[model samples]
Target: MTDGNPDSDGLVVAAFGNRGRLETAEGETLPYLLKGRRLKAVCGDRVQWKQPPQSHEALITDILSRENALQRFDPKGRVEIIAANLTQLMVVLAPTPEPDLFLADRFLCAATLMDCNPVVVCNKTDLQHNDALRAALDEYRQLGYVVVQTCAEPGGNVADLTSLLTGHTSMLVGQSGVGKSSLINALVGDAAAAVGALSDASAEGKHTTSATIMHRLADGTRLIDSPGVREFVPNISASSEVQLGFPEIVALADRCRFANCQHLREPDCAVKQATADGDLSPRRYASYKRMKNITASGSV
Candidate 1:
């Protein structure tokens, strides 16, 4: 989106086909459009663009190769990139709407599959902690997941969570009403993000963030706030690759009798044996099997 250079570098801040916004090296944001069908730019993509000879909008010439990407499958069974080149993923949860431990596990598994650092953010510390919520959080902490307690209200603050995003390009993802937008506002010290509350009747979070957008902290850290979803399925390729996402399963996978064991119904499967021996969390194993089933029905 920059001037003069035929191939200028820019960071894709927001992309919505046909029109996208890019931030140039000098911190200037310019709107541009894709030049061809080769590059499907998404949030957090570093791209190259140039001004067309007789056009006002810059042309996106290229999308650089990404180190990693967080992706999901759409309803049509198409793989979609949610965000790219993220260093960390924060799974936000709250008590009012009741945290879904299975959903949390899915996000954690997605993080592992994407090779990104995962953090569990328990928001709304101001509210009375639900026993079930605390117990679930305890399970995450036991599995070596970094957990942070944060609140984005008057007495409830955001400093603890802000420190985690200091130097990394992080994505904040969770269901609505979990205070993800509120936490983003608090961490970035702004009120631009839309905030929504749970339905009084249903206690379910209202959809707030309609699009994926990026924000920057004062310390040069980039944060992306994504739309809340009721469900999330990573765009993983194979059932065997799913086991690699679970550390406990991977630790025992080599011990299985057969090298190509799926572990669900295979002989001498160490993964299933670990669950029976009480070495692995039954819930995590269950979540693993559920994902295996989900991915098995889709494309490999």
Candidate 2:
């Protein structure tokens, strides 16, 4: 059989070399080699490659354009691109399993810094619910983000969540045991990821030992299942940009007494006043203070 034109483009990624590779859009993961001279590739990178008929292998030639990329600092302090061309980030949190506010804030800030729409997903709602949590989440909904509540075990609200992901490439980020894998199974209707039960000792879900991978949902959209994260340090482009990430803070910054108020121990700070008057979410303001301290440390 004649080979397809090598110029016909394909998505190129680096995977465990021993794992079966991906060559085409058929959803079958296949193995391929980086034929070019020492080029590093990441997930969601588009490239042109050709599969050799003689063997079950392929070769990558070039990387195409990237609309936007999500990156973070690695342990070596190098910026690593986690995903490319993501239109949205589905930040998952489960209340029945217990709430993890720090993890949620980290994911939200990272998504905002990376310029992707951050949507909140509260899973396992059937087990437990809190009015305060709902009201706090509404703050995000009012900011124009789509928020959805889901119960993964009984398939509650999974269909509505699926509809929101249709036709967009999204990344799922949250802490371990947030029903991320369970929700993935519910949405895709397949056990693509192993499901673990919550721990008896700490009421936290066990981690699934698997590599991060991307899968296309039946709705014609791509979803990347990233490994759950425990910590996220914000990489603000500028010290001033930190205010921009906090919606309420940005609104109140202009009214501060000083043009460059840090909002901590500063006289006549509008943000501090707003926090006192209940205009800003106390928890959100606390998170902002923690982040501001981190930024002030010059560690970023």
Best by lDDT: 1
Q: Over the stretch 1-300, how does candidate 2's per-residue lDDT look in tens digits?
A: 145564546664334432223436655556777665565556677766677668677666666778777766555555667777788888887764466675577567777777888889988878656876787688778756678888888637787688888888787777767877777777766545322321123334445524455666666577777666666555555666667667778788999999998787899999999889988778888877777765555343
Model 1 lDDT on a 0 to 1 scale: 0.82
In model 2, which range of ten residues has the least summed lDDT? 194-203
lDDT of each: 0.82, 0.69
Every model's TM-score: 0.89, 0.82
Best-performing candidate as measured by TM-score: 1
